[model samples]
Target: MDEEQDPSGIAPLLMAIAQQDQQSFEQLYRLTSAKLFGICKRMLVQSSDAEDVLQEVYLTVWAKASQFDAQRGKPDTWLTTIARSKCIDRLRLGGVDRHTDLIDLDQLPEPEKIDPVEFASDKQRLDNCLSNLQNQHRTVIRTAFLDGCTYHDLAARTGVPLGTMKSWIRRGLMSLKACLEK
Candidate 1:
């Protein structure tokens, strides 16, 4: 199995990292860096900026390893949150003009077509699972994940507390996972 999917392995690595173990830190980086880098690249347009932010993310992870609570969430989720926050921070600081970097849809190459039969089957399963979620959960999950709204932004827009927003999303995701696994 891929180590990236093994949360059990990561929990121990995080524990060792909390104690300032360099080898464990490197191992953790190897297991998760590609995923985190993709998150950085998605949020920040420039590859150089993404690389810089990714380094900063690892630094933050190293410093804040003790703050991680395995009982509260998965290691990848914690890592992803840190990476995403760092990217947002870089954007907020005006390192890049996000609006100026927008792609012209007309100039983009056409995407490859896929088999509609397979696509519709997977999409139908996802839609069915999403429909099983609570109304608030469904809305929050779609807005947060699909629309790329941050939890803080979602909370503010909906007039709910940040922790409550997070709980709703977490519960929604857990329900979706269980439903999809069937």
Candidate 2:
């Protein structure tokens, strides 16, 4: 927090604060608060809650900066990791699901009724069968079947025609079924 410290020196200043330097701590709070708050706001999506989490992350950073061993990663990653962990902790404690904006149950497309026991059975068999497929086909199937991509998103992402994507996924499913039965 030296008055002449360049913008990139915040991490070292943070390191200084770990040794209990109050002046550096104040300067870091003043310099990095707005950027950190913006990032937290984007992540948490609630101003007051984000502010609370921000405060908590800083307190954590102050208390835990000594835990920031540079060999593991850079300082930005260290600080951001603490911030992200704290926000997740806040969300967990607040009992708010991050996916609250997910499709309403009534509005969701009905998923295929795969028997969970059978589907979860013999994962190795499934992987081996999937490995037999070409990477492009395997990728499309994984995205559509396992990851639940829609026909449109799959088409867009894979740059395949909608019908072709559907066909690849359908054929991939049939192959998997035949392989699993064997």
- For this target, which candidate reaches the highest lDDT against the unseen true structure? 1
Q: List the residue pairs that clash in candidate 2.
A: none
Residues 27-51, candidate 1, lDDT per residue (tens digit)? 9999889978987877776789889
- Measured against the true structure, the TM-scores of the candidates, in listed sequence, are 0.58, 0.50
Candidate 2 residues lying further than 4 Å off, grouped into runs, are 1-7, 95-99, 102-182
> What's each prediction's clash count?
0, 0
What is the lDDT, from 0 to 100, of the residue 119 in candidate 2?
34
- CA RMSD of all predictions: 8.7, 15.7
**Residue 152 miss distance in model 2 (angstroms):** 21
lDDT of 2 by residue, 25-83 (tens): 88878877876786577557778877888999899988987787655655655666777
lDDT score of residue 121 within candidate 1 = 60
